[model samples]
Target: MSNKRRRSIFEIFEEYFENLEKWTERFREALIEKPSWDHRACTMEPLSNIMVTPTEVIVTSDLPYAEENTIHVKPVSEDTIEILAKMKRKIRLDDFGITHYKGGFQTLRCQIRIPVSVDIDKMEVRFKRGIFEIRLPRKQERDI
Candidate 1:
C-alpha cells in the first residue's frame, strides 16, 4: 500500500486563507480606478474587462458612441496601458440633466494596469462595433 498523509485541519484552513487573500487582491485591482483631471466632466465610465492568461493579457472596453478610427491605445508604463477614444458626436452634461457644465465632451479615456510584465511592442489591438480589445504578450524571463 502507498503511504500518503492527509493534510491536517490547520493546514486546510491556512490554504483557504491564502487563497482568499489572493482573490481579494485580484478583485481590488480590477475595481481600482485612477483619477483624472477631466473625470468630473466625463459622463460615463465605459465598462471594461481584463483577462490574464499564461501567455498574454487581454483588455476589452465597451465604448458605445466611440468611433473606430479615433481609438488609440498605448503603453503608459511597463505594467499600464492607456486608451483614448473619441465619440462620433459630442456628449453634453445637459443631456444627462446637469446644466452646471456648459461644454460638451467628445472623448473617452481609461488607464489599465496589468499585473505582469508585457512586451508593449508586440501588442495587438482591435476595434469593432464600438468595442476595443487589446492583447499584450507577457515578457519572457529571458527578455527581462
Candidate 2:
C-alpha cells in the first residue's frame, strides 16, 4: 500500500490562524502609525494621559496655543468623553521648520473612554500653563 498522509482539520485551522496573525500585524502598522493631526478637519489630537484613583479619575491633555475660554468637554456616555478646544492661532508645519507638509491646525480635539465609574455631573476642569485637566469624582459604591 502506498503511504500517504491526509491533512487533519486542526492543521487547516493552524494555517488559517497564521494568516490572520500576519494580516493583523500589517493592519496595526498601516493604521496605528499614521499621524495624529487631521489636516482636513483642521484639528490636532493633543497628547493626553488618564489616571484612575480610588476617589476620582483624572484626565489631562497638553493643549499648547489653546484658548482656555473656548475649551469644551462633553460626556457622550457614562464611560466616554470628548474634548474640544480652539487654538489661539493656527499652527503650521512651517512654524516647526518642516517644509514637506502643507497644512495648519486651528483646534485641539480628542475622544477617550474612562476605565472606571465616575460622576460626570460634578466633574471639575482646570487649564493652566497649556495643560488641560479634568477631575471626575468616582461613583460611590453602595451595599446591597
Off by over 4 Å in 1: 1-44, 100-103, 142-144
Write the residue-wise lDDT of candidate 1 on 1-144 in tens digits.
769888999999999999999999999888864432263555455778899898999999988888888888887887788888888888876887978656567888877889988888898999887779999998876654
CA displacement after TM-score superposition, residue 36 of candidate 2 (Å): 1.7
Error of 2 at 34 (Å): 2.7
Q: Candidates' lDDT values, in order? A: 0.81, 0.92
**lDDT of prediction 1:** 0.81
lDDT of 2 at 124: 98
| Candidate no. 1 TM-score | 0.67
Lowest summed lDDT window (length 10), candidate 1: 34-43
